[model samples]
Target: MAISFDRAADFYDQTRALPPEVADQVTECILRLSRATPETTFFEPGIGTGRIALPLVERGYAYTGVDISEQMMDKLRQKLVGKPHQLTLINADITTLPLESGVFDVAIAAHILHLVADWRSALAEIQRVLKPQGVLIYFHHPGSGATRNDPIDQQWRTILERYSYQADFVGAVTEDVLGYFQAQNLAIETVSVAELPRIRTAAEALQTYCDRIYSNLWQIPEPIFTPAIEDLKTWVQQTYPDLNERFESSYEVTVTAASRAR
Candidate 1:
């Protein structure tokens, strides 16, 4: 099943706002890939809240955004007021979008591939819809490779890999991503990196942030997860409250852009 973000849509935007450093990287890559122009027809699959689409539209680019979440689309719809550019919003799956072949100049999928059951299919869809030699810009947060050291973290990774390897966030490592594009004969044009998209100064702060943000997982009725959240929080507060203010975590991200073979 595709991961659902209906209830988390508002909270996700509230916690993370536009003009954030990370967002700048994502948007900058898109612009570079599109070689931004007035006639550029851009498509953003999983365009949450129009974060990137709205800005592109405002900048005079025509855009079409598609997402599976009605709630997210509703939020994006509310934010569409006063934008005087040609923008079309669709509620559909990226893997099975109803778009004409070779229609878009550039396609973007940001921080969303990991949530799909078959990311390759989405890539195929982008290939099918983008014009020959068109660009595809994608971003991923490879959660698996990030938290592999800790036992609990490693265990979580194992479970996810076992159950959702095909769709697991970061299903493709850097090499895997590069190989996939190369095999398709798509040229890798640019690579940009950003570490720790959201930074916490100390372990305690990280714990607190994780606690508040992941309350749902912690509050689950299941015995395993129920105690894990609170225990982690208490451990952080008691053992490394000072570290919470002194430590930092950088979430490394890579933005890859490739051109479909002509």
Candidate 2:
């Protein structure tokens, strides 16, 4: 169950204040990951709210972004209008985009591949769209290195399924994703040596969970989302016993890069 970034648009930035230095790390890591050349025509699929895309664009990379949410795209549109960037944006699904093939130097599906349903087709399409020797950078949010059967993770899933209005938990594993790219015959490039930051304090974690409920708990009607949210809060309180303490979050992220064989 993939969730779209909608009602979350307004508070998106507020909630996502990654440490300033993290940008440098992401940029450097991506550059190292993809070996992007000056001539690289970068593609950032799922460019939500221009968080990474904007900074990458500022670095003088030619870019194209694709996204499914109109509200998110609208915000990005506003960012691109006033800035000087060598970038283009399209409102389409990455899984089935309307675009030409062999046109770009690199295609980056940043933090988005997991949310797509037909991920294999999307990857194949990405490979098709890139010229031979071009690279594909796939980024994902893993469950912070927690094993698939981690008790905490299982508990979270159970709570969400039974209590959350919509159960939208998608996990992207680094090794498996890398294997998929390899099966396509794309030359393996790099896999980050370090894991990505996944969790935050208990309060932050709780707030994030609650926020998603506001944004993605759509299985229930409007009248029910709130009640369900309250129930979740009560459950969390009873479970944690210390609602103010920062609980660890399990949101690991991974980045893999591969190049089309010549």
Candidate 3:
């Protein structure tokens, strides 16, 4: 079930009640890595709902963003009304971008690198449009690398490790990202890596698993998803007896910035 971020926009907007500062942090990372002078052009692939772009343009950076989902772009367009900054939003996949080469000064991919079929080709496409020394930053959040620290979370990890199926994309991490960027001849550098907070209940966390909230889980057959939940719940209750507690939700974000080789 390949998801168009447009179709997932409402679910995304509804489920996401992010900490206000998190958005600011994304903008700050871009500013720190890319020297955003007034004339410096910027591009974002899969810029769903302008999470980073909206705040970025407010600070006076020129913007060009591409996404496959028109519905998602439509939502982002509504927010750009009367804004005094340059924005060019195109409905296209980042892999086969219909843009000029060497025009952009910076390009950022937030939670998007892992979604592409051939991320190497996507990196090539991104590099095609970047000017010399252009900065490219990728934001990845490998949700809660939670191990045995919490019994219930450990169970969730256990079930996912056993059952979750992602057909094409898999295991996005900082090491793979750096290696890929280096293979593409981009100069890699670290930006900011931190764990960010969110809030969810024990039930909600389990629901995420059951409902296949994570895109990779969608590849798992419906029959398996439910049973995996049932198995996770039953075992947690029987094995970890007093382990139904809820905790503040959090995930780690690894931001790696790469420079286009001249």
Candidate 4:
């Protein structure tokens, strides 16, 4: 079974929010890459809280989202109050979609593949539901090479390593994902979307870890987790003597699009 974001629903948007302009840019990027129009039907697996789906749904495109978490989908529903939109929400797993074959024009997978235990099955399911020539747009943050320079993020990773805590991602790795596309002979088109500036104090970063807002941190055993967090706190205090001093960083959003052959 894939991990579910049911517990993270309350704070998911607060921690993962993109600036309004950046959100618009992402929606526009998907629309342009998928060659979408008003009549295009969009399907998103693991569509927690509709962070990506809302913009398109609000624009009158037909959208269907599936997730294992009812709580996360509820948050999306809360946002849809009184809004005129063509939207359908299903509580289901992505690996075995309950949808009919060849029903959608575009499918979106955003930061979801690595969390699923059977990502290959999920990929096949996405292709099965798409109309011939329909597009799948995969969205993710830039790879480790891009984030290794961020001290706060680096320190947190170090603490986890010191505790010998390995992340529990059961799905396909980056190379495997690209390889799957290649094996299927699906030509991929890649794009880097507009970067969003991020500013946060070292103390704030530590607090976020303490709150366990990230899914990767959720499964850490309590015995290891407590000490790991303490180690991170000590590092932050030493690295930023002034805990309130803000550090600047930017988030890079990347999109890879591939279409099923007719």
lDDT digits (tens) for residues 1-262 of candidate 1 = 5655576676767655644676677676678766877788898888878776766777778888888888877887787676576878888888898988999888887767766657788878988888886888876545444632333344433433444332224334455566778888777765755554344454634444355453224223345444544555555566555763554334555677889555
The residue ranges of model 4 lying beyond 4 angstroms of the native Cα positions read 141-148
Error of 1 at 188 (Å): 0.6
- lDDT agreement with native, every candidate: 0.66, 0.66, 0.71, 0.86
Winner by TM-score between candidate 4 and candidate 1 = 4
Candidate 4 or 2, higher TM-score: 4
Stretches of model 1 off by over 4 angstroms after superposition: 18-22, 147-175, 193-197, 201-221, 242-246
Q: Quick one: how many clashes does candidate 2 have?
A: 6
The deviation in Å at residue 8 for candidate 2 is 2.6
lDDT of 3 by residue, 4-76 (tens): 6754666666565345677777677778778677687889998888877888777777899999888888888
Worst 10 residues of 2 by lDDT: 143-152
Q: What is the C-alpha RMSD of each candidate to the true structure, in Å?
A: 4.4, 4.0, 3.3, 1.7
Poorest 10 consecutive residues by lDDT, candidate 1 = 214-223
Q: Any residue pairs clashing in model 2, and if so which?
A: 144-252, 198-251, 199-249, 201-247, 202-246, 202-247
Number of the candidate with higher TM-score, 1 or 3: 3
Candidate 1 displacement at residue 24 in angstroms: 3.9
Q: What is the lDDT of residue 89 in candidate 2?
A: 80
